[model samples]
Target: MAAEMTVSELVRRARDGQARALGRLISLVEDGSPRLAEVAAELAPHTGGAQVVGLTGPPGVGKSTSTSALVKALRASGRRVGVLAVDPSSPFSGGALLGDRVRMQEHATDDGVFIRSMATRGHLGGLAWSTPQALRVLDAAGFDIVLIETVGVGQSEVDVVSLADTTLVLLAPGMGDGIQAAKAGILEVADVFVVNKADREGADQTVRELKYMISLGRREKGPSWRTPIVRTVAARSEGVDELVQAVTDHRDWLIEHGELDARRVQRAENEIQAVVAARLRAEMGELRGGATLAGLAREIVDGRSDPYRAAEQLLADLRS
Candidate 1:
């Protein structure tokens, strides 16, 4: 039924609050379907409505729990929320290993909440290859806030910074996250720092370390905004409201400092570059399978042409 549904019908139903239609649209994105361009075109006008918030950190910091807490908080405030939980892929089937619906069973029946788990599929930066397009589908579906929970692989989750309006770096006590965060170069990308499991022992010490790090690594010039630290015991829903408030404050600051539009522009630029690169890679694969690359290799093997010259010929073929 979904495959038979036209892109217009899907977009229309999605805008009319049809979850099935929204799911199908995102499925097209994830599978790299032939209709992806049509789906994107249909959803373009409705894009940029939802605020994209990204949560990333090392494993065992309770990111999933905190995301559920955040969904509850946002829903309580009468906001429709969508969550994209990027989970590790199952080696056999290449599907999401952890299903968020099991963890966040409370929100399963809520009409205003939509949760999806996307498998990383070994893509770097702790996100799936199609996350940006999935976010577009959710945004066009009219969710007020879209939360992206990255695969927590410690240092490499910083790609969320490019996509989110506000990026939260979650840490926990006894994780040595402060030093790890600095080493990962994620400290500079964080807009707000969340210290989850704040009730645990050594929580204050963790907070102090983060504060010291933040002070030392403050940006020289940009939005002139200060990153706020919020502590939370996500299991108990403690300090969640303050975290929400901090998110609100950051959004307001972005708008006030005219950084929101700038960020979105950069996001668009990156998306375009990604598409171009993907297309080029596909063409290069075709070249490798065809006689062109084989002939070039034979020439290089026979000492008839150098590698650099053969590369130039390949570039010319690509241009043509």
Candidate 2:
């Protein structure tokens, strides 16, 4: 067992590159301890320094490849990068392949790059339950850029927008139907759009279709904030510099318009809500006694009482 460390000591050790301390701090957050709020308050001053970029798209759209290429480009410009690749968990084994980390081999040994793979564990949002804390760990550790990749199962992964300063939605050449299906959610959240595997046939058509969709939406425009679609063949590192420029341009626009600070404030509020909801659920579970609650759930399922009434009774018991 690791020695018990106070929140301040843990924060100091984590800043000093103590992996054990960092891991413990993340665990505290994951478990929804009140200490997490304390830690977040202490670390808020250190967080806005990092630019968080979220990447999400359908499976097999070359998201990991694109992420690796972007990280390589950013590193070449002398920036420290942190990657959090969120992989879907296997139902039977509860483990993830983390194929993204394997594809990012170029940075495997670089100390300036820290890559971690997280299993979603059925979290409703694309982010893992541990994500906010993981981000805090990276922020405290002093990474200038943080990239988050999510397994895109297509049902509103817009939660990424709440966690990241900018979100890049990746689409491949043959994903026109998928894009059409996800347009409302994807287009609403993405600060920029990336068409990977652009060397493939039909890539231009996809870009045109997306542009048309964006034009149909009614919104106040300021300084040409139209979401620009950049094409890239990430496998070969083609067009990466242009994509980087697009990302930088978007960040610059946000900062100039003062939206960056507004977005960060919104993100902090979302994180607080997520943390509180998780803690309330966990405490409720403990109060009910896990197995006993499971038994009550079975009773409700068997028609003993309506779920709402049962839940109310359980809440009364918890309070008593």
Specify the highest-TM-score model's number: 1
As for candidate 2, its clashing pairs are none
TM-score per prediction, in order, is 0.90, 0.83
> Which parts of model 1 have CA positions greater than 4 angstroms off?
88-98, 121-129, 152-156, 288-310
Which digits, one per residue and each the tens of the lDDT, describe model 1 over residues 1-320?
87898999999998887888888898888777888899989999999989999998777889889999999999999999998887543435645534754854787678799888777543222243478888999999999999988854544356655689998888889886465656756567788999999999989998898788767866532548888899999999999999999999999999999999999998888777777777676676588577788898899999999999998998999998
Clashes of each: 0, 0
lDDT for predicted candidate 1 compared with the true structure: 0.82
Over 4 Å off, model 2: 1-10, 16-42, 89-105, 121-128, 154-156, 176-185, 218-224, 288-299, 302-304
Error of 1 at 176 (Å): 2.5
The true-versus-predicted C-alpha distance at residue 89 of model 1, in Å, is 6.3
Residue 145's C-alpha lDDT in candidate 2?
86
Residue 191 error for model 2, in Å?
0.9
Weakest 10 consecutive residues, lDDT, candidate 1? 120-129
Candidate 1: clashing pairs of residues: none
